[model samples]
Target: MTRGKLFEVAKELLNRELLDKDKCYMLDCHTEIFVWMGRCTSMTERKSSISATEDFLRNEGRSTSTHVTLLTEGLETARFKSNFVNWPKKEELKLYEEGRGKVAAMFKQHGYDVKELLEDDHEPLINCRGTIKVLQVNSGEAYLIPLPDQSKLFSGDCYIVQYTYPGKGRDENLFYAWFGRASQMEDRVDALSHMYAIADSTRGFPTLAQVYQDNEPEQFFSVFQTLIVFKGGKSSRYKKLIAETGMPDETFDETKTALFRVQGKNSNNMQAIQVDQVSSSLNSSYCYILQTGLSVFAWIGNLSSTEDHELLDRMIEIINPTWQPVSIREGSEPDIFWQALGGKTEYPKEKKVKQYIEGPHLFAVTLIEGRQRILKEIYNFTQGDLTTEDVLILDCQSELYVWIGRLSSVTSKEAHILGQKFLEMDILCEGLPQETPMYMVVEGQEPPFFTRHFSWDPSQAIMHGNSFERKLSLLKGGSQQSEVSVRNSWPAGSRGGTPEGSRRNSISSNGRAKSASPIPNVLGVISCTSENQLPYSPSPAEVKLFAGSSPQNGSSDDSLAFASSPALQPMVPPDNVRVDQVEGSDASDNLSIYPYERLKVRSVDPVTGIDITRREAYLSEEEFREIFGITKTAFYQLPKWRQNKLKMSLHLF
Candidate 1:
């Protein structure tokens, strides 16, 4: 009979539902037949073998039959006896004892103690109910060895064969020790084979071997502590394992009978093993052991559930080959593992403000009186250079004023850029309540050439101001003519000019100037008689007096002749002095030519009492108001002397 036939017979007998108590099972080796009772028992069974000729030699007197030969083998007698019996020569026995002692000493050095579970009274052979206890030397705790029932056993199963020497008690001769379930015997054998393969390589389990050689037993126990077992099934075995190992509750999945320990649960140190039944028909199972900290795996056969263990191990190995377990506090909550892996922090970054370059057309930013001011550099084309002019009017105020001369040198592109800059400056100064002011001054130029003023309009988001021509026409002496021209140029009912009734009468109905220094009478002159009567014409001597005294100089060469004239005597002082002498006369005294004096003046209308003169130079109401800081009513109420002073300041005299 072959070994395979013997294994088949053993399996069939062991799986039998019932057996006769009187029957017997036997295994036939070439030289003898090993026999055992058919019924199973809990006690240590004996190994009894009969000679091949014993059946024929049995006498008829024997009442009971010999054990049945259920299995057969074709091995040599001495080799078969050595396997089942424990008899050896003294020399070989000594060598065997020495090797056993050396192996036991090696186990002890690595934190493990080997102890026999069966006593001398029990036969240390096949079918014995004995085990071996592999205890932790320091803690004296047994390992949770896997069993056939998917449960764990504290002690490991041991198979020992003992021999009886002459006149001596039974002595142990041969022995074998193993951990894990009987069903997983093949896997254990495979694992040992793989370990041998590793030992044959250049680099073996050096760290594992060193622990034992160095006698560092305590450290060896730590390697087993990191081991976690996952028994796969529909039961709650994994939960039980977690509880027994004191693992975190989050590690186990009861439904899947799986266990997983991520980097940041209760602890970082962890290892795992999974045992699963793969084929019921073949009665075969698979076991996988994973060293998560080192990203190492050891297994045999295909696992039923590969999602949790196999893929994660492969991923970790690929992503972090040199990863080592982190030593975290026992009850700490898991931090995000990927963040640590990616070397990132939790805090956010700070935001920064935008910056821009300063240019000639750009505005200067300043804070004054708790208010922000965007001061622009305004060129005064009329004043030649802004630095030489008193353009910084009303200092120490919330509002900023800048005199920008006619931006003649500014290109369209520069203007556009400056406009955008000013817009941004306005946005920056949104905190300020008052608007900043920019003045475009063209001195001595009237109407369209008058100073253009601008103010930041927050609602519009643009610098808004009145046109230079329109504002000038609204303020100074020639406004009536400009208004007439504007009204005529526009279509009837157009939305232009002041409404007809809204125009203010500069002259009173009494045919006399309503205010002192009334809009300068460029077209006609009015003379008052001693009787307060209006004179239509002046005498020859009067014409000569006025002709000699040019409007520019306000002085006549024939002053003595004028003094002698009776008509002028009452109007002019006896000292040949004239009333309403131009204020700021000293400032204009050196002027040889006046641009405004060249303008052609038309005669005044007799019926309408309107001046038709086309005055070239003038100031607008807004300009006049800004210059003297006065309202129309206030200007009219001022004394003639002060009024003249303001008019000269405006260059309106």
Candidate 2:
């Protein structure tokens, strides 16, 4: 713990626990050496970090060209951050959210109508997938270097790498200002000036980020096929000799041996981050895919979920469709598998879950007028956060749900993908376990598990109940050739419990029962017989809602007399049909039975979400949508039970 000395606090795969703010340590990561100095460490340790790392590595018999990195406790680089199971990016994401929030608020203040933003002026982030350009500084000036291979880099000189996209003038491209280990102050100043100048040349659309040479983040390395760093750059005396002899251009078939750690669950948000193709890179808690020449090996960790097998299988289909993968369980690795991965060395054998740090966070994907979408953070995860137009991402720590709005655009269906991209680009979901579960919940199909996060009435939709059928049983109306019942297209599973309903479900290939989101109920059509059943009379509330007034003493047949109605006159009955009136019925009693012309028929199958628009046929489709504040198509798409409630709420029963 002393400032002048270097100590190894822990070895091999490291986690956040090893990063105490009170301690300073030298990390030996096989390929690279990093010195972590806590804020409380003495200035001597901070100043001697470079010397200490070199001296320590030399004494340990490591090579002279070993990648060296220096990191402060609070200001750790992305490379250092990704070593842990979950790295909380709360502060970073929060800052980005604040900036986005300000820009988004302007849109909201102006009514979210940004359709005027030229279509040519907008582009998706995917457009930023072009070549990466690297520039090295020489004598307070910068010049482009031959970087045909992304691995071309030297430690003696600072560089500015510009990652460009198709719409170079429309959006901001990322500018990485790299400060090399042996680079001088003049080199850094020149690189920075060039970075800003380059940004300005591109209409100031490129933002600069200062980075270290050997300690680039995972995102930084993703732009390159492989990174090969030389010991010295233009400033070193050996540079001429090295250039003349081509002494240290190390060569290896990087593609022949590669390993990628798979994080996040469900294929949509899953990320396969390439790690050093060594045994120590294997963490017991996560899954990995190894590539050996043309062979693909999916090493399933004992702690990995069944979904890992599926995700890996799908990944194989994408990455190496021609070759069949050899699936190896953690404890049952074959000799050939070990040979391909160098050797079966020591690794983290136990699955470790990080302790929960923050509560659930909610984010929304707001679609502006020009069909462009912006992901903004919501302050709270309440019922109001789930709007009909936005795709909301509810990050509930262990699980995540992408809530698709009923009226959301077709592009919004990709919320799962967009949400993950937003989190990845902003590094907001750093430190989160790679296998954290993510599921999509469409508007009406919200499962109880998803709905529980919001504040709303748990009262089940009344349409799903048999109350309507029960109501008919109390009447003298005939149903000889008819039967009224609910047909739920999808069962609304029990609250806080897995559904054991008779819905057809398939087990995952791994034989583990995967948890699923419950499907909401829908309405089905009812069948009727020759017997005439009395039609459902409008309720007092329904009368007030539709007619603008209720009948005087609405409970009595006399007061609700159809003959005196302003809208329509009562229909006349056939000769064979007899008019039956309740004799001396109480004034408080409603019309339970009525004599009608033929059989009055109206359908209400809210339980099984049937599209029985006939009940409200009197109103035009436009009027229905306008009055109820829901599109006709959207309303029809809802479960019969849900449709019933919405129609009932805005309408008369």
Candidate 3:
């Protein structure tokens, strides 16, 4: 036979064997089989045919290759090598048949019925039983069911499978299926069997691949064309299916009329416009139902096509207006999906409060005072040393004082209500009884204690040490004698007492006081003699009589007698002693009899000669106000009593 005729013969044999046995095969079956044939067939037509036949039998491992060698000596021998070839044995054919039976049974198990076709018979075009029908493609008269509605069929399509269920009559059943694009009959059969197997395992048709392509258009756009599939019919159960698939409600007008555009990866801003209704080319001719009772169909081309609109209308009418197209934008809030998938949502932000005051008015008095008081109370109640520039003076109900100044220098007392600006001032002014006397000195005023009060005698002023001893002795009465009393009791001309010629020397020949002694102690002696002349020697008993009468315990007669004594008269410096020298000289250096000898003294007038060192003469609130020229309203506004208590508590009096 010719090479073409021999190839035809091989192809016919393969087709007949596969059709009869129903064995699954891979793609490129023709190429593989023919390529093998071409390799062994290059001799005479008959020998080539035989060689081709031998290779096929050997290739399938059903038989071995054969060889005959001739000898020149007439000793002929025929040997069968291990590569001997022969036709398929009965046992091999039986095994193939058995395998075919198992495959058919498996297809049935998966809800697909395999039907073989005869050479002269035409495969039915309509789905009468409404059951899944898989056409055996190897048969010469294999079925050629048209593509389902909206389903695109490319060239070389082989498998024509159907999914459907029985209804009231032959024409009333639903149908659906996938038209495969496999080129070879063997490949078509393999695909159909695999699809059924998947369906059995998944409990549904193998539509996952189709749905995946639909969702991921960007990835699969170049590989396959996308389509919008729909289905409808009486007794169709698709409500749950529609919802699960995220389809829009059937009541949507565009969905009912199929008035929409399907956006693909390459399309932009495709508008959904209404189109006139028309009949669908795929209606009734190419649809099916699965064992799952899902009636499905698809539109192969654009949804904007008139055929798709008509198909949508027909589906709506048949399915009682319950069939709907999927809405890409429909479903739970978009954020909900993102949240379910661990995405974040944006929310409004909160506002912040301001920190510092900026105007000349300072902070609001009420609020700032309240806050400051609370802070002060915390520190004060805890006895904490923490201090702040803001100060607050609070009683049981309200703040009596508030002040703010330089932050760094505020003392603990002022930290509660006053600022650092008052550090140099007497701001320790709280916690005293209301009856206590105090004063408030603001900026630009000196404390009353520091102000010079001219109503005192400098010449008669004694050192603090001597003054303290004198006061103590007077309080206890001179009957309790000590060294101080002995020193003061010495005769007038003694070393520690007034000198004999001091008074005579202080008086010049002009009868004016001579220049006072430069030594303050000698000057004191002169001042004393100039004021009073004591008896040349005063005995201890006389000294006791003079010093024993104290204001606290002395009888009025004793006070009168002591006041009348010349020794008790206020001392006056001689006229020659410069007043300015006495006032400006460091009294501490001259009065070195005390431990605090460096302390300065405030000069006093000779006439009044008040002992300003006495606590009783310290400035009172009324006296302070008078001295500083402060108003009553302003003075009372402060916590005057508390201020005094704080100063006293701090030993700052």
Identify the candidate with maximal lDDT.
2
Total backbone clashes of candidate 3, pairs 3 or more residues apart or in separate chains:
34
Clashes of each: 7, 18, 34
Relative to the unseen true structure, what is the Cα RMSD of model 3?
Answer: 53.0
Per residue, candidate 3 scores C-alpha lDDT tens digits across 116-235 of 111121222222233344332333234443444322232223333334432212111111123322233343444445444434443211121111111221212222223332322111
Model 1 scores a C-alpha lDDT of 0.25
Residue pairs with colliding backbones in model 1 are: 378-404, 379-404, 379-405, 380-405, 381-405, 475-620, 475-621
Error of 3 at 600 (Å): 94
Off by over 4 Å in 2: 1-170, 178-194, 212-251, 254-277, 291-296, 305-324, 340-343, 350-653
> For model 2, what is the alpha-carbon lDDT of residue 420?
49
lDDT of 1 by residue, 345-397 (tens): 33211111111111112122211111111132322112122221112221111
Candidate 2 lDDT, tens digit per residue, 1-653?
45556765665566677776666677676776566766465555555665666677778898865655555454454455656656656422111223233433443453321111111211122333567788878877777877654445666667778876443123325667777665667777677677766765663223345566534433445444344454356743335445787776222243456677765435433445456678998987678878787777889987677876776666556544676777889999888788877888998765442222223556655433222233445542355445544566776555556776544542222443544443343334344443344455555444434554554432221112222221222243533221111122222322232222211122211122322211111101111112222122222322121122222322222111122222111122122322242112131133222212111232242322211222333344555455555555555554443443334333323
Native-to-model Cα distance after best TM-score fit, residue 334 in candidate 3, in Å: 30
Candidates in descending lDDT order: 2, 1, 3
Better of 2 and 3 by TM-score: 2
Rank candidates by TM-score, best first: 2, 1, 3
Q: What lDDT is obtained when candidate 3 is compared to the true structure?
A: 0.25
